[model samples]
Target: MSKVRIYTIAKELGIDNAEMLSILDDLGVSYKSVSSTIEEDTVELIKGIIAEGGSRAAQSGAGASTEAEAAQTSQTQTPQPQTQVQPEQVAQAPATAAPAADSGMTAEELAELAALEAEEAAEQAATAARAELPHRAPVVTIMGHVDHGKTSLLDYIRSSKVAAKEAGGITQHVGAFEAQTSRGKVVFIDTPGHEAFTTIRARGANVADIAIIVIAADDSLMPQTREAIAHAQAAGVPMLVAINKVDLPQADPERVKADLTTINLVPEDYGGDVITVPVSARTGEGVEDLLEYISLTAELEDLRADPKGKFGGVIIESRVDKQAGVLATVMVQEGTLKVGDFLVVGENYGKVKAMTDSAGKRIKDAGPSTPVQILGFSEAPSSGELVASASNEHEARELVAQRQEQRRDEEEARKKPRLSLDDILGPLSEAHTVNLILRADTQGSLEAIQGILAKKETDDVKLNVMLAGIGAPTEGDVLLASTADATILCFSVVPSGAVKKAAENKEIDLKSYRIIYEMIDEVDRLIKGNLEPVYEEQYLGRAEVRMVIRHPKTGNIAGSYVTDGLFKRGAKARVTRGKEVVFEGTVAGLKRFKDDVREVRQGLECGINLDWDEVQEGDVIEASEMVEVEQ
Candidate 1:
């Protein structure tokens, strides 16, 4: 290593930032800040100084050395660019005999130099791309606690009952709108306020020019409200506090302001730069002032994008619309998106047959900062992935293929996958081997995955691609994988009910993924002994209470309407009544029109029995299940 940041070194040694600074000061090492990088030799000296500090420091140093050794080992395992050097370069080396001082450095040193050059080139390319991109309208993200009037505020701006149309009158997914206010044209991203959609909120903040954190005046600061602020700060986006529900009798804006100071978000009135506006989403009071503030802030920031740069955007959400096939909502960040443009999104490629704005109005084209729903993809693209234009259909396909191949090759095998209980506890085979039966939606996807696995093959650890095909996994595949103790991986394809049941019975590991990166990542993490916990709550569905049935025998039967996702009979459930989780239990029973049911999709009505009597009208019921997953 040439140089490393002090914070990075501290992290490697599992020590606090302040402790690292203290140690550096004690050693008489000169550093501008924790972020300042020091030379490799200086770092070694610092390590030696720590080792001499006593036994406690010595033990820490020992642990840190082991960690450093492991990191170095992994780096050595990585294939070097020099290994793929062209024959012309090797032949030309002898021509420069005068410059070959002691035959120059070894292959390892040369490889490191090549890696550094490659990194610098990549950074320069990124800088050039950013400089060339044109600027567009300001993109603002709305974030806050559940039922804190985020949707209501947008509804007011758009002059529509958006909240009323949403499931449970709560936003379930991210939605973007281009608002042409009196002040200026600004794009707003409405992110789900529910805790389950924290990732989406973070994504929203990441893409936004400003974050308007909605805080309910009556509620002050809730858990999700605090989380929203943290996300905005982490994303480095300018924030404007919107204290909503100001019309409520119990509303107290002062309490919200007080809580803001605790989080280091002091308002302008409190001798801080943070701007706070009290608004009533229900009545639209003070909303005009909020818009003016956002517009002014956006103008001051001078956010820009080049409309002539390569067309690109981020997928806010993608789904299979039963009538329209694959539909993806993309917010154009640069260049221009047209109706007939062919685009590549991550590993999926598509042609834009049509483009519709947030209001479902069809349009010919969209510029930077404009959100549009595109139709005519081969399949639904992965959410939060990049979507950019290709020269043509053939070019789009080729581009996505190359991307998938590069992605798989770039991923580190032992650090990619989520940790299942089986992965963490299962004993490794005497022979280091990973057997797999792979299935994909397309031949290209299958080939891409196989190419990466081939590269992962080593003398010590054998990677066996036992079966690679295009389609959902069959019962036969499951049986063979079971007998061989191999894993079954499905990319963009799902196993049938029979196949799932067979795998369950045989205790075979079966995994499915919609994105190529996630599939490869999970496989990389499959190498046991290098695992991280991946137990996550997978959201199933959300529902709203239509009517509460006080059944004589069945406790409280919630006559609910499914809002978002689906509801399973035995799924883990939570009931929220106006920002508070009133009940957390299981979906003990489910029914449709008085008939017992196993599953219910969104936009449907069903009777749900939580085995709890506290079910009330207007309460939101969310269904989820804990499973091993990754980001």
Candidate 2:
């Protein structure tokens, strides 16, 4: 049977689409949006819910919408006339099956389309087997402030000296390990505690089922400690506090508990749900209790994944080894990962040549919540990327090829001209913009830098970070910088002497910094003083708001009439109420009626959605474009 959309079913029952969507969410049904197709079984399940007196709303209790309750009652007692199924009610099939145009597509486009089909197929298969999967282990992550004994605690649990092996006695990398507790097996992820590793720690929380926050008893709560708590809470993961260094002479668990209460993490002993355990990683005190608490929490969560279907997981860490080639530490989330299985990780494909557990023992297979070092990736996979086991080597290779093609297409799309040759030779203008290329040694550093640079903008001066990537600055970077009249900024990455010489020959500025503070300082200076203005923003159009439509997946899409000039998709827009600027962001999407267009002429109606922080119905949207000019 062809899948029917949730909105169609809602229309048939004479209920609001949003109400039905909430019902599906309460029933634990997976859906991307109301337009998403539902299986035949799911359709029957909804009918059964209506047939059973529709008590699901009451069971949800407090804050239940009375209108929704009436709608459910009407669904059961009265049968509305059948509505005609709309063309959009049918889920569109994979685009790969659509014949290419007469001109045919490039190999890259074909590969990307094929990869999308494969991924959609995999998702459907995983959903089919989801209901039958048994409960799996819960993955827990440890996060805290620097020198708060996070690694030391993991070492005590695993009986290994990982802390001693770390550089500068601080955890710099995210590590995953499994421990056989008396209650059961619990997987643990150790995340770095430094402020610079914020992205890594957030990724850790995102993938874990539970979080253990370590706070030194002697020091109480620190700034990073608060940040770690915020990350775990933002991920919606349950957290348990581990007060470490309690064996110290100055250790005070009560003082730490008071600080935790201030952050809204009241201890269970203090009449709250947050569980706080006192322990000393140095002496192993209260460590067993901590393990027991973790097992109990996992039992309550009832975490599970299919062990009989296609294997899938996420890459926690990856590095290139001289002898082992590309080794990746992967934590399996669903199904069973066995030796010799063909796998696609990010843009890399490989056959599993060997699997070693955290203890260095060769394992034949791994199930959910198991972290193992696997050898065989063709290249180093990125951390936090999803990994799926394909049916065979051919399928894995095709998937990887498709992903690589998609990446290339995205890079090409983002390759706007930083500065054309003619523009560079022209005189200065009013709009001062500094174009830059950023290269970093790691993903974490790149993310940190991007976040920092995004906030370095002024009314007249704009810091446009054209490209950011991992690895050292290369000749290609120098060429791009020379063409765009942009500078090459490197963080913790040194360019080869030959590349530096090439940059010097081209008279392109190349700067490198080991410290984030120093890099930010230099970028600020360049944006404020060194960069010359070449263009100024000119008003392209103004639109009067007509209506606002809230899309489930795309947020708010505005319906407006172009009052003057022309409205375009790529133009920058600012929302104003009266004379005050409410928001300033890009026009991320635009449409005319049902069809999408590049631009709408004056006195035309169109739909627009901004990348702005917020949008209201009556806000006036003023669009502008930067126009080049000579002084």
Candidate 3:
């Protein structure tokens, strides 16, 4: 008889290869991989037993054996003299059917079939361990560009002043909250809009079941907005668009809708699947509609969890609460969490002493999709740490200790001696290149720096950007840079204190700057082996325009009084109105009491001519001289 491969039979039964192999193991059946074949009669016996246990169904829709075959086989092997098994029962228990037909089967086949029966009995006893958990609130992540009303919309929905609480109205950390709308309660994860928090935003997108991409009606789609869309897409979650700030006079919902098409997120009104709703985070217009859509989405997803089984969740934020000790905000993804449950998160272990919802209301239990603050962790877990409930305190402790040991080992491995610049450049004398890890505050800045560095390559030396990312330089980046013998360059992103300390410990070269052009210029200087400062600007004098005097031959000249230093005739002048510079040119002409003069002293009145027009009264003219200096 032909033999059937385990994988081919498993595929027919709609069972995973690994699961089938485990089942075969429990039955004492011989097999190597899933491709290992078994006797045809043994395969028929196992399938009949699986069908009898109701663990699986026949691949062909017609029961175990067809009507004609079952009748013929049953009549031949099963005699009415001793005991007769019904045909319906035989059909239901197909594995036993083969045995009744072949009463003289081998002992090995009999033993394996008996083993499967015992295993199915054991499984039936342990089935339905937990009651079915009801559908939970949808966890929605809010993401957008800075000043695009993300926090404002969250504030209005939660009815809290979170925006006001943020320093400079910029969210510095990820915030999780639960809000009760008329439809039902919805959990919201507010991610920082700045590009420096890309990791945090990605984490938010990862944990959320739904994403709300906030777009200001007046502000076009920005780089961060596109990044948010990309993050949401990469996470494979459903998304809703919130067109905020509709109350503003310049708010253009239609224009925003049109711009969204560029990113393939066409509005529902435009025959697309994406739901776009206009809302005013300031005055609460159309806010209820957004919540309704979220509720509908949750219903469509039919989100559920096992309430009585193992509890698992993701850590949203963790900090050492001065009064409460280690407090962590967690979003429950499965099962139910209660006070006094043994929990393990990352390298920490503890019993849940207390739990509270976003409103600070003490709760004894938290279900799936609920964000709660729990106390009693042995150590503060990092953000994005996954949480799991253990069977007992001892088990949790053991897991925590094991994880801590693993982390220590990994850290020690990373501390291995790193390569130095001399180690690389010293070996190559003729041709040399500087490997650099570049980090910037925004995606655009990172791309610009990478482009500039790539274009600046030369025959003698080349500037290679080993890694470029939109975030503050992290310790991992420092380690990579150290291993690669690369210097780290940061533009408009300040490294955290911990990262800075790590870099110092590693003795890595890290250069940070706020201006993009300055960083580019320094890299240019480094590439050309020109370390000396060629020229530096010095403040010459400042003057306030008292009157604007226009001439046919010369451009707009300002009748001004020297405020500080001495105004030189050939010094560069910058005209500033308020905080913005209006014009930058050289001081073409200077006159003191109608006498052509090269310089005018402070506290004196003079007439200054500039190359540009629009010299308004009360505008301040700043003069500076370029003086060549040594390195």
Candidate 4:
């Protein structure tokens, strides 16, 4: 049966539209307006509520005449008077909005017209919401190669020694702080490097206004330097290159500028638009010119924000503090944030009980372009989570509930198995990951094998054929397979004596097939986790923790001495206490001599940070790296 519009139900019940809406709200039935349609079940439920003495301000159109008096009475009625409707009962509704039964139109058609009118009205309302306030400072993000003086540059700009606080004098995490420059106030985001910078740029969150690439004049362009420039290009933000460490004897600003030209970042001295400044973070040489250029860029960009706008910010960093609860450092992009205000962030809502500025000073409120730490979240919100303000606690709770429900629905959808190659290969799991290199005698054979591999790869277990070539197996193929730790799969191809010798020496698996079905069956078995591994772990170093030191900034770390070989950062680690393996994870961090180091040799003591933190004294931490070997 067709749904009945609200006006028709109101007319049949001998009540005004406003009174009908009041009953709907009191009954907790969601609705839009008089143009909205109600299901037959809902209509019966409403009637039952009214019959049971449901309370409303008015009934039978009483106490609502004055509100409807201003509406134009231009609608023609049909013989059925029950479908008659009055204007102004649905919040200044149009006069031509006759009930569905008399309007000779479907309920959907009426809703469409009402929605069109509402959209126009909403547009007008949005135009009126543009807030006017003081101008905002420009937020700058520093990005470049590691150890290229990104943190050092910020240190010089803020007149603070931030790098000295880090483990290896390298920024390990993303952070933002405001600075007072000669050209007005500016905010700087000291990120871990271009990786974090790219992550922040990839997010739609409004964060950075300018990107400053710190290039060491001595080191010139590094791999990460080009990567940082590429990220800045993709982000579409204006950039300035800070040729750092110019005070050194080997500093060559001209060479740096020449190298930058190859990447389209031509310097101003080269008659290009890109600006470059030679500066030393240590000596503070040419630093004033850099700040002046930043101010000039901000002025040219005309950065401004409305402090009274709807509160919105992006969480740049968040961590669980041992004392102050969850501390979330947020970059305020728009509007104002103050203590006692409720904020909703990704299924989590928190009342801001306190705020601290960049300088670690307490602040009452923060405006746009301000970085403030928010305390009071029961749990730490994720980085890059967007913040939304609510008028009160009730609204914030409602929003959180809605977001949580949505997240659960999304998770349920994700839990379903994806339709991919798994249908052919039974079911693929993470343990079934296989890497192969396809070598075939003919192009057609190569494509056929590739087709089989590409038919349907699963996310859990993927069939990665690094290279597909139509040729006999060669020494190069063996070398590549040895390097990538992959198996060589051959279809109608033979290997020479040299290639075989090389494969035997390197222990690279070589599977040759004369028939396609035989190959497919073997591949199915291989991808199903039946293949033997061609790589083995080579022990790098072993360390015994003699002491455990606790610190407020770095957390719990093991003070250990390398006994056998050496310990390396990012190497696969296994922590063993006596005979039981307590933790099997990567070495997250390693430090020696109060500085971060990549590797430490034997008979030397260093600090080890593992993913598993319950490390105790006398625990043996073994570091290992993967190496290709016989299957």
Candidate 5:
């Protein structure tokens, strides 16, 4: 190699090129001074120096031998311009060269030359790997409704047991877990069963490779179930249905299958191949079958990872661990990860100090299909961030700095002033529009709300229900609404305190209502002033207090007239003392005197009895109405 190439190699090896000159000095290699341009003879001499184990004396011997070879070769034949030499002539020249001086190079020199070449090659490999590494994971989030056993199914899958869990078990932070099976491993993110996942869903991350939808066999297909299916379909992932609680006495698998058919999940029982596993998590039944199904599906899809490259993965979740410091559960999609490897995850970079598998076992390294908790990140990485490993700390820091600059530039771009509607569309254009994100407690409620709002669509002021789902309002949903400059309409589902605060800070309108029609009516009114708000209160049937025929002194029966709404026969009934429950008890009887009744409707009176002895005049008796209002 020439002196310039040697300097390049030295710099790459983190050695000062000045030191290379010093080594040449001790080698006694006679050469034009440092300021002179590198000659072909000098290049050969340097190669000889490297071949002789890079020692000063050995380099001098190799340089002397190279000079001797050049002298003898020049006498025998004129030195041709190597750059223009034909391949055949170059090959022949090497074969006919004077061997004595060339062979004088020592084993140490040869080894040193090979070492430098290997180092340069390794650096090139690392640079290529870094360029190829992907920075994010395929975030897979679960969605469904309350009481539909969504959490139960996830808990069963995560814990490998379902009996020891509580009702509505997932009550707090949205957790992420990695499940390994025969086919491969998958990271399951248990997002809050709220509209937040929908927003994440809309972002196109937090969607699954396959959506495992849980629906109760006994309950059949519910509105929430349909909404979950819709969201999954919208996300465009293959879906499998887990018909849960099959151990229940009233569980009807056929009914659920029939119900699912309407929603396009035609079950095998009905002659379609859409896999529906009848599972009873409480009994640990069909869990193995479910795993097998997942494996088979993955095989068919050919899910694969290029494990030969630099490490790249997605951050399933991240949190500050008391002992481990900032920990992140990352699904390694490619390459190997070891302790002390510098990693750049999103805007953060760190030297990995330790790693643990999903089971919390200490591991020295992790590869593809492995889900491991990584320690030593500079900061907590956001969920869904893509992580990559660098060859050194400096490179890692540079990569992070570049990413930060790119993000800053993006933010600045978004802040750049934009032309107004009048500038784009002209002041003569007469058009108005409203965008809304609709969320509800149940699928039925969402459908009802959507149906009501769909009626208000028009040419000028269009009511765009940008996104709708069945769940509580989540921070992601709030963020999405803020980004879209849209209003949120929540029906029945409560908004979390954090989401409420975010909404307030963002100045986004979050309207919540218990009645479906009222929600629709208000949306209609906002979207179009011509559409008067039509409120309809729903009466969900009624129940009565029968046999109040046994009043003693006052000769007054204390039975209830359930003009509307449902009344559980023995549920606590309160006399409304200005919205306060004064009288609450079991209904002693429900009847029209000579007969017993399960429920009483509006404009109907039923005889009932109270356990209390007190009866007074001017006391108004009103039955609670199960009303849900909609436009």
Candidate 6:
């Protein structure tokens, strides 16, 4: 019989070679070499060692006789050992568990147990992948007043020296980008800092891990800046102040820091741990340090994401590009996203045909913390929308439909009017039923309007401002008002052309006033039915009296030069004699020769008939549209 080596037994047992050797050593097996083979006799001896409860004495004098017999039998036809056990290992085999007295376990039971263990192991791996992905990114949104260098700062960061030469400058589209540093990566969202961006930021901040509030060092903190800080706080994300424009001569970092401290963002240099970096987007100074700090913060927070799970991301911004059709900047939050993967962004779903980074370079796949512009969406999604990818196109479509239904439900809930204090109280009370949909040009205006309206509530007619936000009035506002039977009010905000048309069609009564007090007063009067339509008069081209034709009964027909303003048939006419008013009456008829006309332009001669007066030579007729005053 040939000797079977320990290696052979270890290989058969599915255990490591080293562990097999360790087991032999513990059993006090005498071996000539590591490579020594175990023969038939050796197998019998090892089985004896096992039966002896792994005792070192089991291989002594008494076992030597049994071993000799086994060696003799080995020379003939090999006898099957009583138990198939390797040398130097004496323990009850895991496969041979004690069975119940009534029945013994079958081979199928062992195989079933192994299968169950394998399934559990697979489940654990999947669970670990899910557990590793971070829920959100350190979303740093650039914000400040309009034209205050918010976009410029973002451009500087994107075009940093570390960026590849092939990478273009900061993308105009609002999406997130990763600034890679020596330590780690920091994600920065390029958002508009104007009042319109507030809505964008509020949505972005919802999933933010951190916020970077960019303030011009020269200007300190403006009203919008304060509002941004409050928004970041309200989102519950830690903030890092980036005092930009440090290269400018008027830049005052210290003053900016002082101003920020009042808002509770004390700089680290000012004895506070809140990181404040003095940067110059123009000079590209201190950007590295800023990125390093951001990376360090992220490291401390242990940001990580699972690349083996389902993909989820956020839509930074979306727009219809002339060339690309619809483009979206998506910040991938988790899992691997590859080209051709089916994805659903809000209510839209599509197979990803192309993926591009902020620099517009096409890529095959994007992992966690990657901000890529994805192509092939079924439709363009709105900014700040949540996106997720499924296993296949069908799943993606189903998910999109589910999301659309959910959004419809949410919108319906928002449109449902609630009972205000005025609704609960009698109309005789001082409270006025002020129902308005407020829009503003800036966040400050929106906040101010909401604050004032909130405070002006009364027991009888409480201010029932339906919605207040920063941006031009949208069609959604018009539709919401039309459904809720509410009026739309705008403060320093222009209604979009579509919204204007919708408002007119719905008779929703859209009002825009610049003065805050005037707006409040108009709303107050409107609730009380004391408000009326206000109009302004406009001047049209006028005509000079050229030739007169007397009529028997009708007024005298005067031929005149159509000059300066438009001549309306029923407009009030004033005959001015060298800046002195001579006659005041309505223009009964206006015509070019025998043709009766509603208006005539300058340099054209026209015949005009007055209601109760006659025109003289060199008479200057001033035409004006009369407007009624509102009380």
Better of 1 and 6 by TM-score: 6
Q: For model 4, how does the per-residue alpha-carbon lDDT over 1-631 read when each residue is reduced to its tens digit?
A: 6788776688798876667878888878766445356799989988887786644545535647754653434223323345643333333544354555567754555666667888999987865553234568988888888899988888787664222333444322337876677657888886646556544443456478899999999999885676567556656688889999999999999999998886566786676778788999999999887887787677656677888788899988889878878988888888999999999888888899998877666789999998888897898987667889999999999998999899898878779856655544444333455767777888788778778777746555578666566667766566556545678888888888888888898788988899977877777776656433456889898999999988677678999999999888989999998999999999889898689999999999999988556999989999999886643
For candidate 5, the TM-score is: 0.48
Whole-model Cα lDDT of every candidate shown, in order: 0.76, 0.76, 0.75, 0.77, 0.64, 0.68
Total clashes in model 5, counting residue pairs 3 or more apart in sequence or in different chains:
27
Q: What TM-score does structure 6 among the candidates reach?
A: 0.46
lDDT, candidate 6, 292-401, per-residue tens: 55654554455677777778777777778888777778877778889988878666688888888865577899887778887787578876677777889788778878
Clashes in candidate 1: how many? 9
Q: How well does candidate 2 score on lDDT at residue 192?
A: 45
Q: Per-residue lDDT for 184-287 in model 2, tens only? A: 68888754442212333323324688888999999998855765675565456788899999999999999999888865677765766678889999999999
Q: Give the per-residue lDDT digits (tens) of candidate 3, residues 416-439.
A: 957675543354436666777778
> TM-score of every model?
0.44, 0.46, 0.47, 0.45, 0.48, 0.46
Which parts of model 4 are misplaced by more than 4 Å? 1-133, 160-174, 409-631
Residue pairs clashing, model 2 = none
Number of clashes in model 3?
A: 2
List where candidate 2 sits over 4 angstroms from the true fold.
Answer: 1-132, 160-174, 190-205, 412-631
Q: For this target, which candidate reaches the highest TM-score against the unseen true structure?
A: 5
Report per-prediction Cα RMSD to one decimal.
28.8, 20.1, 29.8, 27.6, 33.1, 30.5
Error of 3 at 247 (Å): 1.6
Off by over 4 Å in 5: 1-143, 146-207, 220-231, 258-274, 419-436, 439-631
Instruction: State which candidate, 1 or 3, has the greater TM-score.
Output: 3
Q: Estimate the TM-score for candidate 4.
A: 0.45
Stretches of candidate 6 off by over 4 Å are 1-137, 167-174, 194-207, 268-273, 321-324, 403-631
Candidate 1, position 42, lDDT = 80
* Inter-residue clash pairs, candidate 1: 133-306, 134-304, 134-305, 134-306, 135-304, 135-305, 413-524, 417-522, 417-525
